[model samples]
Target: MSQGKQLPEFENEDDLAAWIESHDTSEYMDQMIEATDEIEVLRTRFSTKPLDVRLRTEYLEAIEELAERRGLPYQALVQRWLLERLTQEAPDLMTK
Candidate 1:
């Protein structure tokens, strides 16, 4: 639902193959594989169910304030935080 975060839609291998072929260049295969690997990492990291955390009123307010200041929804802020943490902890698990 975010402004620029549309989920990907790949109907089938033919569609994907067409896309790959259309974008093909000498380095495109390597880049495409790297991007696919990165997407797999993202799926593995973020597919886990969220854990419930109890927060004090003031702490919750602070988080909300920070999210508002960054112009991001609370969930997006949390996702970015987790992604950053994961990338820092496992540098090889991320891609450019």
Candidate 2:
């Protein structure tokens, strides 16, 4: 690769991963590790917002039951359901 040359934009996560691997020398690998760690920290920091939700026992039970039926943890199911609802209700929130 030439100095000052720019790589093309990766279209998806898989493409990005492949590009990173292809570019991996010892120095570039270290940079990739640091970049991945920083990305994880960014994801955690952004997802750290507090939510004070109040759900009735019946609703909670329903969620648990649905989660059990889907073989997913209750919290995972609840989070996915809430995400779906928010996405449907306010589609532009994700774009922002």
Candidate 3:
């Protein structure tokens, strides 16, 4: 973002919303500049098989606590941990 960048002054949220309704997002795309180390987009998709497991209450609580602090679902945190371990140890395990 550049300093002193001026945006059109709208009367209120309704005005802004009305303006947006008439505008194409691409019209302002040029105003969007990528900052250093910023990502343009993030997307993920893959076929997955569901895995269900019961965890002891204490373990579940610990996972939930850490996941909350990291802003991730507990299952995602678990999956990432498993993936990291597999990638570090036997990378072949991740394929099948």
- Which ranges of candidate 1 are over 4 A from the true structure? 1-48, 92-96
Full-model lDDT for every candidate: 0.70, 0.72, 0.81
Residue 41, candidate 3: C-alpha displacement in angstroms: 5.3
**Which 10 consecutive positions of candidate 1 have the poorest summed lDDT?**
31-40
Query: Which tens-of-lDDT digit does each residue in 1-96 have in candidate 2?
Result: 335445556689999888777873544332333434433344333544667788999998998899999999988887788889999999889645
Candidate 3 TM-score, C-alpha based = 0.51
> How displaced is residue 62 in candidate 1, in Å?
0.7
Rank by TM-score (best first): 3, 2, 1
Full ranking by lDDT = 3, 2, 1
Q: In each prediction, how many residue pairs overlap at the backbone (N, C-alpha, C within less than 3 A)?
A: 0, 0, 0
Which has the better TM-score: candidate 1, or candidate 2?
A: 2
Cα distance off (Å), candidate 2, residue 56: 1.5
Which residues of candidate 3, in runs, are more than 4 Å off? Answer: 1-44
What lDDT does model 1 reach? 0.70
* TM-score for all models, in order of appearance: 0.41, 0.44, 0.51
State which candidate has the highest lDDT: 3
lDDT of 3 at 59: 98
In candidate 3, what are the lDDT values of residues 12-55, reduced to their tens digit?
98997997788765545556555689567967778889998899
Sequence-dependent TM-score of model 2: 0.44
